[model samples]
Target chain A: MKIDKESIKKIAHLARLEFDENSAEKMSKDMSKILDWVEQLNEVDTSNVEPLTTMSSEVNDMREDKVGTHMSHDEALKNAPKRDSDYFRVPKVLE
Target chain B: MEKFSSFDEIKKSLEKKETDCRAIVEYYLKNIQTKAHLNAFVDVYEQSALEKADQLDEKIAKGKAGKLAGMVVGIKDVLNYQGQEANASSKILKGYISQFTTTAVQRLIDEDAIIIGRLNCDEFGMGSSNENSAHGKVLNALDESRVPGGSSGGSAVAVQANLCTVSLGTDTGGSVRQPAAFTGIIGMKPTYSRVSRWGLIAYASSFDTIGIFSKTVKDNALVMEIMAGHDEMDSTSSRKPVHPYSELLHFDKKVKIAYIQETIDSSALQPEIKENTLSVLEKLKAEGHEVEEVHFPLLKYALPTYYILTTAEASSNLSRFDGVKYGYRTPNAHNLESMYKLTRSEGFSEEVKRRIMLGTFVLSASYYDAYFTKAQKVRRLIKDFSENLLADFDYIIMPTTPTTAFKFGEHSGDPVAMYLEDLFTVQASVSGVPAISLPNGKDKSGMPIGLQILANSFKEAELYAFSNYITQITS
Candidate 1:
């Protein structure tokens, strides 16, 4: 259950969040403590159980193919941070 | 103007022409202004509320007002408000405006309920205390030095202070109920899929539910009925017919009730809370209702099960905020990778980052089965355990929280300690059953103790009726 700094860095990279060495160290300790506490769940005998991912028993598996309420072209682009007239502009990913 | 606790009282005043909708709105507005130090509202819509109230008053005069004509409501910051900022109390979405109104908010407005403002909450509803809000913490009106239990602390405080008739809050675990307990009011989380989650800002999607805070159970039921129907916007919304909960407030039947012996006898429980809870149980038995103390061995596992699933869900849900489409983008980001990392690091609070990291760790390929899969199985065990118990007993009763409102920063030093604040209320959320926190009498310090009740899923009418009856006899 011990979370090392390397694991912290790896998780942070995957989550797309960053922290300094000190904060990451603190996070590593916090996560280790939390995970250690969560380790108690292993005691419960869930071997015969199925994971209940969904809450509602009677949920519609599929939404209709028909169109529902949506924003217009201008409305969709209204909240973009670095947007041109039509598209949401972002930092270049490729060289 | 005198204070109004229920919509019925407000409606009576309107009927007698003693007070108009404008007058009601003005009274709440004045209260909001006078108690500005509580920091309940993130943004108050003065012009919009007044304008809507005047129009509703005109409609009332013509005898054509909608169901919630005289009701004033404040929404938690997470709900979409069309053009208003739906920040979720996070700096990432500080300037973001909702393009569409949430299905729940729209329904309230359609019923002629005037929305007074957006109330503050823990950032992305992540923290149990409101201290994590970027807009700053909400103070408990009853005890300013204490923490208002969160992530819906502001919503609870607004209703507690009479700043609004009823306020809407979202409960992923115990956000609504815990705060309602701290502030001493009625807080309810309906069955999962009972209310549409179309425009609600995502936290932990599976557990997240739009809840209500009100001074009276009838008022809570009235708002619950209007907000409970299925919507085309949310496929997860139940198509089950929503009962007119307000009209069914009479409970003449004797019901079987269960209280977890482990929870009541736990050393962590405040003595006053335990006494009040047992006292209520005694009252229930005196009334000839069956009250039993049940052993739920899995009660200890509910917290871990809740944390594992919610953190996993939250990490995925929060991935959408990468500084591309909206909200805060860092000025120093030179490329795509840095943009996402830097913006998020700068935007999110410490608690949020910790959860996202924990979620990522649990879902990692190497440990997925050990943490994520195992927790999911535990969740099933917990949910089924609750359902089976509820099958035999009509309800489960307990204190909403282990203690009354603690002073600020009491548990903030440790993340796990803060998570424990939800120990009592998480069972209802884990089960997706309807649960309510009725104001039990205050502790020795005069802080409120909440009496929580859990019932079978989709039994909101029965829950409301029982809760109403409990409040009456217990009060």
Candidate 2:
């Protein structure tokens, strides 16, 4: 629960966010407070409890994979802020 | 009168041509305009709604209309209705027009339900109050200064204000129920996966459920029947046959009701809320129904455990909204990493960013076992408690919130306090049980209080039965 600025910075980076020093300081304090509260779960007797990964008791409700009419290329590109003729444009990923 | 009292009433009036669909749509449009100060809607498609009403009039003339014909249902902005922007009240999703309709919305359209407009909500369904919405806050219809509990605040308010006959809302952790309680309307979050999530923007996939808001339990039941079913596109949608909820509304009342005493007995409850909820319980007991107190000790940890699990899943689910795929993109980035950083920084609200950061931290390899995994274990303990408790009772009852609707900014500075508003409702979400909030009484300020009822998973019929009994008694 003792989060520091460095830990906050790492968490931001892992979440793909870039925070300034001020935000890091604030986040560190806020996160520490939250973690302190969440740590109360440790006192509960969960030794006999099984972990629940999925809520659905019935599984494998898969459908037959068939070709269906999906959104058109233009329609899919309509919402993109940066788009090319056939693809979404983004900052260069490779040199 | 008043454009018909309910959808069934509207359908009959439309069929008999006592009032045309155009008249009904115009009446609701006028109501929406007069109540614009409530900030209940993000967008109102007046022309589209009128056009749909005209089409339904033709269908009625040709004797081809279905149930809910010409009845307008306000949609929460998170749902994708083809050709309308599904912004989810977030600037991040601004101008994002859904190319395809959600199966649930489409089914309503096919049944001749009019899409009146899109209601406002918390950005990405992150906040319990409507104040977090990028479009601005939606005020409670009953009291302008108080919050219409959110993120489904607008949907609940719209129905309360008579802007629409009913509205669809998504409830993750009391999103629908809390707002319904605050606004003095009926809201039901059905069992997880009971309704399709295909068109819903994911909040927490495990707990996100499509719910309905209406003035009456019968109206909510009718809307649920129309919207509930299996959808192939949504992997988690139930393959079970959809039950006829309207028929089930008339089910025999030989059912047991268990008042969840341990959960309600917590010291956090306000005296007024406790007294009002207890009175409602007394009414249920006097109706010749079996009633008892059931204890679930693990219920205490549900709030923290829900936050941990939901935030962890949210961090992963929201990762797909990077600038490269869609949504807002920032200019002047030298590389993909910088672009990702700037886009997310500008697009997401402060609350969203905070949650994503916390989520990533909790789910990180170093802390996964201690936080995320442990929360999942606690989630199981909660679910097991529900399963065992439900074996003895047909439904469980409790106060929907510790206090009635609070004034705006009452808990704004303290996020933890705002989160505790969901303490009583999160248990049902975690357990995947169907639950509802029905307006039971009012506080000293005249703000409404809601009585919550929880039924075992896929037992919506029993939940509705209990709700109908309460509705009859209260009416």
Candidate 3:
């Protein structure tokens, strides 16, 4: 339940978030407290219990395969931070 | 002749042409402006609301007004209202405009409801107190110094203060009912998937249900009747037939109610709330309804299980907010890696980041079974057990919160204690059952005390019937 600073940093990296040493130390402390609280679930016997997926087990209503777009190209790109023409622009992955 | 207050009274007045929709809209706009210090609204669509009100007035003249003809409404910041800033009160979505309307809001519009503004809320619906909102905290209208139970704090305040007729709020684990309790109004979270989640900003998909905050049970019932139906757009939307909840509120059958002994007898609940809840039960029993005390030992585990599952889902749901596609991007980032990290770290608040980290840790390779899977299994146990109890009991009544509205800085220092504010309400979210909070009584300070009524999944009609009966006798 004691989430160390290094572990917090690794998880932050995995979650696409960055924290300085100070915030990371704070996060480590907060997570330890929260996780320690959540550790009480271990006291319950959930053996052989299936993980509940959705709210209901109702069969998903399937639809025919069809091609459609919710938004026009312009509308879709409207909120992008950087966009060129119709595509979102991100930093170049390759040199 | 009496003052028009509730939705039905307003509807009658509008139909009789005693008052026009435009006048109603103007009155609510004035109220919103006057109560601006409450910080309930993130943005007010003044022009659009007036224009819609004018059109509805025309429709009324022609006898073609829609179901919600003269009603004015406010939407929570988390729902997309099309071309409006539905930012979920977070900095990450600061400048984002919704491209499409959520099904729920669209239905409201179709019914001739004028949407006055978008209400504030906890950032991405995370915090128990409204203080987490990036825009600013929403003060409880009852007492500005006290916190309005949140993340639906603004929506609750809007209704409680009469800024709008009814406001839409999303409840993902006590967001709707808790705040409604704090503000002393009727807040109902319909069964999960009862209302479509198509354009709702996701917090926890399974638990994210669009709820309504209104002053009367009938207003909530009517709105639920209008909005609850199958939407092909949202796969999780229930395909079952939507019941006529508003019309069915007069089912006078006696209800067999159960109150959890642990919840009422617990030391955590404040004595005032316990006394009020017990009084309400006694009132129900006095009405010849069967009210029993049920032993619920699993009450303690509901909170931890809720946190684990919701945060795990939220971590995955919120990952889409990275800088590239939309929302806030760091001013300087040379590479994609730094861009993602900087954007997220700068965009999210400390609470959000902590939850994301907790979620990531739980779903991490080493602790997946111990946390995520274990929580999921426990979730099933809670859901099934609660549903079985609901099968035998007509309704489960409990105190909405352990204590009433807390002072501004009371529990903000400890996240766990703040999270425990949901101890009594999360059972409904975890079980996907329909639950409602109504003004039970008040503390000595006159701050409201709310009692919750819960029914089985998709049985909102029965829930409303019981609520209407309770309201009638109590009033």
lDDT of each: 0.93, 0.87, 0.90
* Error of model 1, residue B442, in angstroms: 0.8
Which ten-residue region of model 3 chain B has the weakest summed lDDT? B1-10
Q: For model 2, how does the per-residue alpha-carbon lDDT over B1-475 read when each residue is reduced to its tens digit? A: 5645477787677667789999999999999999999999889999999998999889888988888887789999999999988888877787788999988899899889999999999998988889998899999988888999999999999999999999999999999999999988899999998999998998899999999999878888888888897887888888777788877887555668788776568898888889888887777678777878876777779999999998998999889878876667888688998888888878888788888988998899999989998999999888888877888788888988888888888987766788888989999999999999999889889999899999998888778877987888876
lDDT of candidate 2 at residue B328, scale 0 to 100: 77
Model number 1 iRMSD:
1.2
lDDT per residue, candidate 3, B76-157, as tens digits?
9999988988789999998999999999999988988889999999999998889998999999998999988899999999
TM-score of each: 0.99, 0.98, 0.98
Q: Candidate 1: misplaced stretches above 4 Å?
A: A61-64
| Backbone collisions counted per model | 0, 0, 0
Query: Any runs in candidate 2 off by more than 4 Å, and if so which?
Result: B1-3
RMSD of 2: 1.4
TM-score of chain A, every prediction, order shown? 0.88, 0.91, 0.89
Better of 1 and 2 by TM-score: 1
Give per-residue CA lDDT, model 3, range A1-95, as digits (tens). 89898887789889999888898888888889998999999899988899887785457589888998888999989999999997898886654
